[model samples]
Target: MRSDVRDRIERAVDLMSTRMADEDAPPSLDELAGAAAFSKFHFHRVFRIVTGETCAQALARLRLARGTNALQRRERSVTDAAFLAGYGSSQSFAKALKMQTGKTASELRNEPHILARLVERLAHVEMAGGEAGPRLLAIEIARFDPFEIVAVRTEALYPDVAGTFSALASALGGTQGVTAIIGRAHDDLEGGVDGRPVFDCGFRLRAGDAAVPAGAEAMTVAGGEHLRARHIGSYRALPGTVDIIYRMILGRSDLILADRPTVFHYVDDPGETAEASLRTDIHVPICRIASPKEKESK
Candidate 1:
């Protein structure tokens, strides 16, 4: 696909995502197509071909994902969750939940482990659109010792990750010991859309003398070797960038993925920076296999 066409489709996807996050009602097909500057009919065909799901299917999945988060909240009743998810009634919400997750609403609420499994399953569901980007700018490998960090954890959506950084900055309070500002995703985009994802947004802490704030938690990033890539542009394009990286990782026989969550270091403040100029460094952990000759010698 042409890069221009791919970018247009991505713009449409971004619009749809913004609407879904902001309002209970999904945007009309005409609105989405218009956002892409395409005719409604042609947009429909291209959208499905590019995203692998119909527009309606994509909307429904997004709604169901949001509903899953609401249903899991202890403070919100099932009826309340259903309404918040834009469903007319609890019956309809329950039916949709079951259809998507193979579990009833009650089952999800009462069984915490079941709910966890459901969240994991949802996290793996790709937003059915957009081909992966053709390339990443520069890839590198780096190693480091475990580093201490002070951060605030939130259940904010992926789009809000940048928004949460300010709170972390405030918590840091111009401390001279602060290093790089980092954001780590505890769940994937699917999990984030479902509202169950946890993100630790904060800065790396240098040694000594700085006091940890009341609400912030201090933790360490496990020291290890990792595959790194620099992503430039909107955070919304991260999934595609990540997809390309994973593809590259899988294609190599001598590389082994580590059991670790991916880490993103923000190079620019999203709140102060335009989306088009944002920069983030992504790190994926890996273990390298020794060459056959080296293995034999060992």
Candidate 2:
């Protein structure tokens, strides 16, 4: 990525943080455009190009993500969350919130924690459209280590995984970190048998040496055995590639998937499409599925 473009994106994120901080603030598009060093006419398009959403789309997403987080974990009131997220009134927030989620604000607050998780997961559907690129280079077991990431996560399925990844990358602006899409490609893990095709998709962020920014918290990937593969192709073909990898490797039973697969786009270039040169190293954490004899021995 060009340093100039990278700098502008960081500036845009900074401007967004400032805008969100002011409770009474109604920031103008012109200010955001200036902060991004983009022309007012082009800012909306450019911002969407870089972040996978228009400025308004990103704002709503961030607001909702923050509001949901507050609603579920912080025990904060819906009224407070509404205002904190720049909503004019709880009524307005509740209407939109209920549209996105089946539950009303008060209902959501009283609902079980699982309901909140359901809401969080359902919110990711809008981020999937993005530029398609070429396949990622192959990777091996020695390439990565257990590391930490802080991210704003969602569960919506996107039209394009590459676009979803781009939003994750944008969310990490101003930080020295790699934004990666974490997910399990398919279930069943059996060869030649098309089983259920469900996987977990979320973001993995690595905090850099720089001071951690507000609202970015830390989470860790535990150390364990993993099955690794490097895929080189268009984004659309990844699901099949992942399926193929599982069939070949897991068929041999050298590893069994401990959880979902992690698609690591370690060398993503923000300025270009994946077709220009795509590279994502996928890792599925695994352990030996104990045999009957092993269980008996234990």
Candidate 3:
């Protein structure tokens, strides 16, 4: 895509994200085109190219996501989740939820059926509706001490993050100080600036005299409690694993999401690993919400 054209599309998508975040809905077609600075007649064509979905389709997906999260995480009742999700009633919200995810409000609320439903949903979406071969996903929690990294940033999508890693590697001339290579997504592509996801391709700095390269910046990765999941197979499937993680998170009453970027630690060298054999460990920052009794005591 032409840089100018891409920039315009990103600007419009950014606006859409802004509307979605603030209002739990999307703006009208005229508003979208205005945000893109294009004629309404022509903007849709370009937007479809950039995002691969109509404005309504994309926004609806985002809306469903908000409802799902709110229903799961914010102590919202089903009715509240529906209203915040822009639905007229809880029944309508339940129907839409079933249509999009093949699960009910109660199932989503408690996840009594999380395992059976989530894995199936993950495979179908990640495989693009292909036959769902076996997939493995597991979540665990661990405490991380403060660590450092030498990293480079880009506005590239996750699939294209390899180039940034290559550039960082070449700049450093070798992995002398590196303990592990990790990827950090700084923004959601759907809600990111100009609709482009920002990512950091970084090497974990070992505890030693490892020097930071001239071009890359040194920073401390967060240290705290994290919910981690292991992903097996292609990097493209990582999003599916992420969906499962969020679903699990929503079902929990004792855990609330912490404000931090989810980080992926590369467990295998993709250069030498088969696509099906690739291993990645994903870390989601989190905190334990005190129980009601604990809160009452405070």
Candidate 4:
């Protein structure tokens, strides 16, 4: 089979579209992977490579986005929204949502999920390997609902990051939390306007907080609406995804981009050797753009 990354990504997106058609009923991972003709083991990585998020994370975000839309614009119930998102139990979902978002689902529905506004600015920074010089990139809008993630986190920068991660992994001792090491990049794709690329490299815990790495933090993804997609391949592939989102906004209705931080949601362990290349889920928090008239009034 041809190893065309775009083709595989389109297929994965198609599968996601199909799954969202009926939130109450969704496709299994194996079945979904089959749609893209990807290996069950390697499919998750491929999906992440193309879309920048894992299959599970994308699905959950889609569900939450739907639910957020409903809550904000319509008279929707949390339970109904949860059920539609394929949640087995609302209580469990809500609990996880509160942790990631720093607010309950109901709270977001009632109030805006705001990040201190960022100037709609553009800048440049270097890549991780230090091979390339600074490149121009912008931090765009993103919005996502809370989801569960088991991660090892620390306040460290690159080069030293690997060692810090090793120490964190050792401290974890296979206890609870994330079972896999997932990298979450909350900074701009351009490494932000600053030279430092802020990151939280951690593994998903198995059960409890006991497995949390020393000096690492554990939190649930706040439940709410999210503007998300998959980013296939290395961290270098992120810029393309951002461009696509901007184009989508231009073509779609007057959905203005808002100041929501973006997230690089990892699908597989970067340390794991796989038949396929690396992959990650790219998510941004965005709100609808206001009309010219609406903007003027504001």
- The lDDT values for all models are 0.69, 0.52, 0.67, 0.50
lDDT of 2 by residue, 1-298 (tens): 2344446755775666556545435356667767866544334433444454555565665566556666775568888877776678888877778877878876776776755685455344232223323333553453356655554333333223445445544555632454564543332222101112223333564444323344434545555666677766555555545544444332443444454334344445535545536665666555666777887999
List TM-scores for all candidates, in order. 0.55, 0.38, 0.55, 0.40
Instruction: Name the better of 1 and 3 by lDDT.
Output: 1
Backbone clashes for every candidate come to 2, 14, 0, 47
Q: What is the C-alpha RMSD of each candidate to the true structure, in Å?
A: 15.3, 19.0, 17.2, 19.8
The regions of model 2 sitting more than 4 angstroms off are: 1-144, 158-171, 174-217, 260-263, 273-276, 288-298
The weakest ten consecutive residues by lDDT in model 2 span 188-197
lDDT of 4 by residue, 26-51 (tens): 56655765776644433443354445
How far in Å is the alpha carbon of 251 misplaced in model 4? Answer: 6.9
Candidate 3: TM-score? 0.55
- Taking all chains together, the TM-score of candidate 1 against the true structure is 0.55
Candidate 1: which pairs clash?
Answer: 51-128, 51-129
Judge candidate 2 against the unseen true structure and give its global Cα lDDT, from 0 to 1. Answer: 0.52
Say which candidate scores most in lDDT.
1
Arranged by lDDT, best first = 1, 3, 2, 4
lDDT of 3 by residue, 1-298 (tens): 2344556667776777667657854776667777776544335434654455545556666666656666655467989878877888999988988987787888766673563444333222110112122334466887788677888877786677788888888787766666798887655423332445567789986677457777778867777888898888998878667655644553467764565667889988788799999999888777898898999999
